[model samples]
Target: MALIQGQSVDSAVRNALPPRNLGDAERLVSGALGAVVALWAIRRGGLAGGLATLAGAAMIARGTSGYCPVTETLSAKPAERQIARKQGWRSAAAAASSVTIAKPVEDVYRFFRDVANLPRFMRHVESVTVIDETRSHWVVRAPLGRTVEWDATITEDRPNERIGWRSDAGAQVRNIGWIEFRPAPGGRGTEVRAAIAYEPLAGQLGRLVAQLWGEEPGKQAHDDLRRLKQVLETGEVPTPALRRADADAAMPDAA
Candidate 1:
């Protein structure tokens, strides 16, 4: 078991690294191709045009081979994971933040069960639709507040226990998460746990913003729960279930 887990971790590490299989000749060929395109563009157009083509060709080579030399040289070492704690990623931002809700199991379950009720506590979520009994469409506001949409199918729906969901292929913000509701140890309240995994959009801007605004995601989760607890315990209007139904009813049917 130890050996298998070790190999699995190694495999994941290797997959994270850009391929270095290309020989020196291949690297030269890529550079030469970039040069050629740039030269042609310069002759036909100008320096600015030439530079643009050269950049494009360089991107193509790096992307096609999956070996970006720049990334290889600048990439940071992967963080060592604690033997007892296995979560988060060195390459991508990951965290599991949880909060307790002082509510009954059925009320909490009903609140989360309705897709339209998401905006109440889901800060990044813009809209949600119940396409059918276990499937839904979601338009989530991206990290930097851009609108991203995705379709998701609910997996596990154990009443008062847990709810699991995974985004379909077409989802803009691909994610998988489980919301678990467990009775408080002393029967005081319900303990809510959420574990989510996702990969953000691919781009330099996305990477930079993710790194810069790293704490915001976790903070949002915390704030969302605080707000949710307030709404659920206080009978507020921003409940996830109410928000969804309101949005759905407001939309007109297609002509």
Candidate 2:
């Protein structure tokens, strides 16, 4: 949890994505995996096997319910849980990170408020061209030093509040996420939270990469917010050509 002022990004994320149920396909796969583990346990001494089976069942239940007790305790809420059953693919992954900008809540919020400014700080973001008011084209630098391009559209947004989005169909990775900002304790600053749910293209292998990478995604999220703060507070971000275009639009053209 990162606090810009008195706000806790973790707490806002907890409130944004409420717990929900997993997709049918995820429930089915989890049940099957549980059954297999149960069979293996039966062949063994039954005690350890029973424990393993219980654990597996619990995982399946949590996946199906889309609610994990641990997540609840950790101040996280479920945003999306969709099952992609095409070509025998089954996997689940989630990550979150937050950072406090030294600046006030409104300043920090406005910086992130402009999705067009995302690539200025988000390292993994290669390009975010706003094709329209709701849709945009994104080129992402993959975790393993690779690049994949896709389209994303804003699904939900509440100014000075929250922003949420999802990937377009046929994307290399199925991803969804959101950002949240809130007022601080003494009204001195703000809290910022970022949450992402993504399934890589390689199934288990992708999950392995994510785990090995651990919280790199979250760390990057923090970095992006910090840079955003610097840019907003000091106006120091090397303005990109696109940003310049935005600026030009804001100024009047002398005839």
Candidate 3:
């Protein structure tokens, strides 16, 4: 959302043009790398060193200023590119997850359709409060015991099939997400797919940092789905204590 805005794809393509498309976490990463490279490059004091210095500067600007014009045409997919243009979204990070649950497709869809149910399975989602039929308020846990609040509007809804949503105006974190539920091949249960695209902001960037430290969104999404399955079938969600006890029970016995 922070990327190049107010540009239409049909107008024309420019070689280098964009806005602050990077986030805090991205900037930190790029800045750190650039610093290392420049420090090393400066010692040589020649043409190759100069080129490396330029590379380091580019990386620094990418993270610090959050602007990377090259991304405008990075992976231009006709249809998806058009959609991103129309929506004013230039996201840099995305995640997708899929899971099969032992519940009917309709049942799975219903659970996801109700925003209030998300906190139960999604460990980081503090709560989702309904505002109206298509609008909802969300509070999500962030790093360092922080939290971010946002309002989101449902963009698409197809019974027992799909649902899509995006953050409303003035939201601190700009995000777009979707969920799909389909019948399993063997008629066993529901196959669910979920995806999210978000721009890095002060609040959301914290989560990105955490992602790098082993709690990536894609992995978390799958864990949430597993919890959802437990909720639906066993009416039980695995707790940390329970997992610890189980691990202890499974340990080898001394001879």
**Clash totals for all candidate models:** 3, 1, 1
* Model 3 local distance difference test score: 0.78
Task: Order candidates by TM-score, high to low.
Answer: 3, 1, 2
Model 1: per-residue Cα lDDT over 1-255, one tens digit each:
999999999999988876774566666777776767766776777667867786857755764564776554333323212211232322333346777778877888889888788787676777888899999998876556577788999989999899999888766666677888887777767888876655556633454465565524456666677777777887674657988998999999989
Worst 10 residues of 1 by lDDT: 76-85
The number of residue pairs in model 1 that clash at the backbone is 3
Candidate 3: where is the Cα deviation over 4 Å? 1-90, 202-208, 213-215, 243-255
Worst 10 residues of 3 by lDDT: 72-81
Question: Who is ahead in TM-score, 1 or 2?
Answer: 1
TM-score of each: 0.55, 0.54, 0.61
The C-alpha stretches of model 2 lying farther than 4 A from their native spots are 1-89, 210-215, 236-255
Which candidate comes out best when scored by lDDT? 3
RMSD vs true structure, all candidates: 13.9, 15.7, 10.9
Model 3, position 69: C-alpha lDDT score: 59
TM-score, candidate number 2:
0.54
Model 2 per-residue lDDT tens digits across residues 1-255: 335643766668767865654556766776777677767777775679779878777876766567655434333223323333332225545667776565676666676767788888887788888888888888888766788888888899788888899888887777778988877666656778888766665755564464466424456666677776667656765559867888989999899
lDDT of 3 by residue, 1-255 (tens): 423453544334543545566667877999999998899899987999999999999898787777765543243335544545666755334568888898998888898889899898898899899999999999987655778899999999999999999999988777788988999899889999888766544333444565655555567777888888898888779899988998999999989
